[model samples]
Target: MPGKLTITRKISYDTFVQVMEKKGAPDSLAENIIAQRKYTLSKLDRRFVKELLFGSLRWYAKLYWILQKTSNRDLDKVTAQIKTALILGSYQIFYMSKVPDRSAVNESVEYIRYAGQANAVKFVNGILRTISRRAEYFPKPDKNKHPSQYLALQYAHPKWLVDRWSKRFNFERLKIILNANNQQAPNTIRVNSQKVPAHDLLNFKQSILREDKNTVYNKSLATCLVLKDSPNLEIGSQFAEGKYTIQDGSSQLVGHLVQPKEGEYIIDACVGPGGKSGHIVELSKGKAKVTAVDFSLAQINKAKTNLLRLGHDKIEFVCQDFLDFTPTQKPDKILLDAPCSGLGVLRKHPEGKWLKSPRIVHNMARRQQALLKHSLQILKDGGEIIYSVCSFEEEETIKQKEWLEREYKDAVSFPELSTRLPENYKYLLTKENILLILPGNKYSMDGFGAFIIRKNESVSNCRQAK
Candidate 1:
């Protein structure tokens, strides 16, 4: 009877714990997995769960501080499941006006019982009920005394991230950046220009083809489209016919910077999962000879699959690291889309905000520098190399650009990209005139830092001198 009762009552709670175990204790993961499970959650119920998970995780430190003040025992000594239940229940009581106090207390008590802790059910119920009744009496810290703490609690970010941004960016800009990361990322797709023209794709409209029928579609830009939601575009005939490829708006800008001409030969170093590499082939109108290289055979196979599905035969994918791969013919241009801490695209991948550290940025900067140096060697005389990273961190972006300037000196020329930028984005140009895109900008481009460097003719000639 106990086993049967447990099975019936614990199914949803067990699924939540399983998701937390697999995806870590991040609130977003919990919410996503729960929603995807199709567990009869009403919209309101789902919203409350999401807020509880994300809000608790976001301000976990402050919540733990509050818990410490209330209890005599160390918070860490508390069982993981019990702590999670408390956080969830406490969040509901404190934040969710729609969630009844009795439901929060009863459900949490049931959750503890389901976790094989029937002894702690009364404790759980009592604590949640007490907190619910005296919620206003909880000590609230003054924002003026601890601005970082206040922001950490309010926005649900770590104090360290808040402190880092406070020093690096102005308060207002940092607030905007943090707020953007907390929000859901819009789904943007890039038109497969080789197969479908942007204008034709946008003009041809059908209900099933539309991501959001209510949202207006723009046709002029070949680079990107921000959809209201992730559509079942894969099932659509247009997508099956290779009309477009899903890519972040900021990533679409990388192809624009590469500026692959119709007949030029281009090397896409570090091409993996082939989104941008495929975009390059599409942008070049199937006229450019593309050598897409990656370190992993698995990714090379994936690129091959994508190319095959799209009916592309012009692009050659090499399953070899760029550092070791030897090309039979020199490329007219090279695009080094180097790997780095993905700090810039945090809005799209909120999980990354917690995963990345400052040291990872430094390590990535070193790897990027090495890749850039090698890219210069492979590039042809007077060829262009676009160094790009999906990171706004100075160590990887501005600092890397500065290092390139000092190292290459007159060997490279930074292009005036502002002249070519979409009118809405002319102001993001750096002093030396490189393009640095931030989120919430006029262009709504994902945060990015790219440098379009043209190899000096004199430098190529000097190599000939040697």
Candidate 2:
């Protein structure tokens, strides 16, 4: 019953594979997203192609499971184009209800030919057509026989991750988390109040736009807006004018936590594309001096471009690994937005689940620990460090926090964040009161976790200030 793969000489998922393979390469996700902007595809074509690319990767595990059963061959034995086509075709047939089944199959068959695998036309067609009919029979991992396997194949996640989350969350919540991750996140951007308030852009007569009430949970964000629908619009109208930048609302919260004061000095570690670093400058009313550092020169250049567009000319841009780069001046505050498994923003980048593993998480946690040690050394005494990651993995989050607390028992402690969040979103806090935002939590926002730690400060003083 294995689906047959015809070896062909054509390339497929060219863009998707290129982006996916760049996993830990110099350019990060934000950089890739920006690079994608240069593509000449129309809005409709771009959306469709991107959806297929990201969607196929997001559902890769389940697709491979289905393919193995259908083809009777190891997935690796299949030609790359055939495999990519099958995955793309299956994703549309199963997950993309908006797409017509016949069209999905036809396009895939044609795609194989376009990939120069003319001989594979029938094989790709047959498997997709057969799958279209037996879709319900696939992804049927029995719950009673194998609960972890059930969640893994059914939810399209690595079995190890599902197992960990299964133990961490109740069954229902885990399902919600997985299902939310599968859904497309709305396109949201933070309007630059320093240049233009979000309200002024509303009904500005350039393009159709709507303000989603749930885009942001915090009133102080002041610049968040969710795009109602993907429409062809002029980048010159607003973005080119430095009126706003594409940033997730979840990311905007760290700026609020930063609470940068006018003329204060701040350092943004791993500040790629400069989204948060720009937010910090905006929050400080353009008075704060931000020193943004990144390990990649490419990312630093990209961040510099975005910063320039945001009217920032004087912010220091350092291209050096945070661990090796010594600061010329101690920062009054620092945002160690340390990179991790990216488990939290899976909804935004579902390819992560397919490309990441437990070993990667462990290694990253160790690396993050070293970065934290170095950051602490450069941090001025009594200055605050907003430690954060776009992931909920214990190795990258709570355990990391515990590590910091343990190693610096006499030197550091977390500040109370409950008072920092709106009353409705206060539930985002953990039992330890650490901020751990989950996917599809009240705001339908991306999952993010952050903890504010103030050095050389008493717990009582921090609590009182909060």
Candidate 3:
């Protein structure tokens, strides 16, 4: 009876706790599970629950520190329900300007009581109350002496990541990236050109702008729109009709880089949920021969369903590992959107702050190297491959590119990639023609590293030529 968590009648709070307890799950999965709960939540209540769940996750470390400072107790030793309630309460007290501190403290104290954590109610109240009063005076790790700890606690990033990144990036730049990761990411959509022509989408933008000023056309991307405050897109007629697909501007760039021709065959390796594959179809005006591959059957099935919904049915769907799957026909181009540590997109998936470790990044780099090698094998002579990962880790990006050039004498960096980029975005391209998109750039895009490599000859030809 002392430490048991009781399901309270407050639907939103109960759901928030339930979602919080699902450790190691992706943020999206947690959101789905929360939505599937039996309780019917009002629109307002749903928003509150999501804010608590995601915001707490985003600032998990910072909230924990604040609670520890206020309570002078080892939250590590407290029951999880008590800690979660305290974190939720501290998030509102310190971060949510719209929420009254009194309300936050009361709700947390009440949730603890309802959860049967009678011993923690007083502890939770004292912590939240003290935080509400003296949060400004609370101490943080010294920036000079404990830079990693300071940045981690101040920005809610993993200390290991902060320490690792600090070695590669200057302090100012690392701080910029960390701060950007803590901010709300915009919802970017790639207009399905087949369904909504540029002129039609322009008209739709004007209409939506009339309703929501935060909605605006992307300056550099002709077929992209960004919503700083996104509405319920699933309910919108335009989204329902497949006029646009929810994708980040960073990912939309991958489609542009692929530049699938009308008759060219393209392979999207690691086609998770098929966003880029669908983009290829739209870019090619539904004329490119495309094959989407993923090792997970669930991912391939999801891609198949999504592509079909977007009116792209001719594309092949293969549920096999990219390393083993070879196409019957050689592809003119390949888009190896390989999986990585996902350190680049931490803003969108804040759970990574808690879930990811340096070891994960190192392990992922090894897999990426293998995927790149196998992809080169299946490509035709002179065919190009856009090697991409949603990561900025040196091991995954520059090192992988270097390794390809060293291992395969025929592999050369694409020469004309600079000419393909929009004028404004040419800055994203390095002198070597690699696209290095950092999170805190003016585009507000996720961090990503992509480079194009062309197989100058067949493997046997390469050997003979050497």
Using TM-score, give the best candidate's number. 3
Clashing pairs in 3: none
Residue 199 displacement in candidate 2 (angstroms): 7.3
- The segments of candidate 3 whose C-alpha lies over 4 angstroms from its true place after superposition are 1-22, 209-214, 411-413, 460-466
On the 0 to 100 scale, the lDDT of residue 14 in model 3 is 52
Order of the predicted models by TM-score, top scorer first: 3, 2, 1
Question: Candidates 2 and 3: which is better by TM-score?
Answer: 3
Judge candidate 2 against the unseen true structure and give its global Cα lDDT, from 0 to 1: 0.75
On lDDT, the leading prediction is: 3
On a 0 to 100 scale, what is the lDDT of residue 240 in model 2?
Answer: 68
Q: Candidate 2 on 1-466: residue-level lDDT in tens?
A: 2223221101225544455555532124433554655534455555666667777877888887887788755768767777877887888898879988887787777767766888888788888888989854644867878888888888799888888888889878988999889888876777777876556654432433322222222233457666565422356555666777788777888888888998899999899889999999888889999999999998999999888988888799889888888888888999999988788888777777877777888988888888777777778888988988888777887888787777677578687887666566677789876788888676777888888877884433332210
**In each prediction, how many residue pairs overlap at the backbone (N, C-alpha, C within less than 3 A)?**
1, 7, 0
The C-alpha stretches of model 1 lying farther than 4 A from their native spots are 1-73, 86-134, 137-141, 207-223, 233-241, 305-309, 457-466
Question: Following a full C-alpha superposition, what root-mean-square deviation does model 1 have from the true structure?
Answer: 5.0
Q: Model 2: what TM-score?
A: 0.86
lDDT of 1 by residue, 286-355 (tens): 7788999999997888788777667676788887878887688777888888998877776655445555
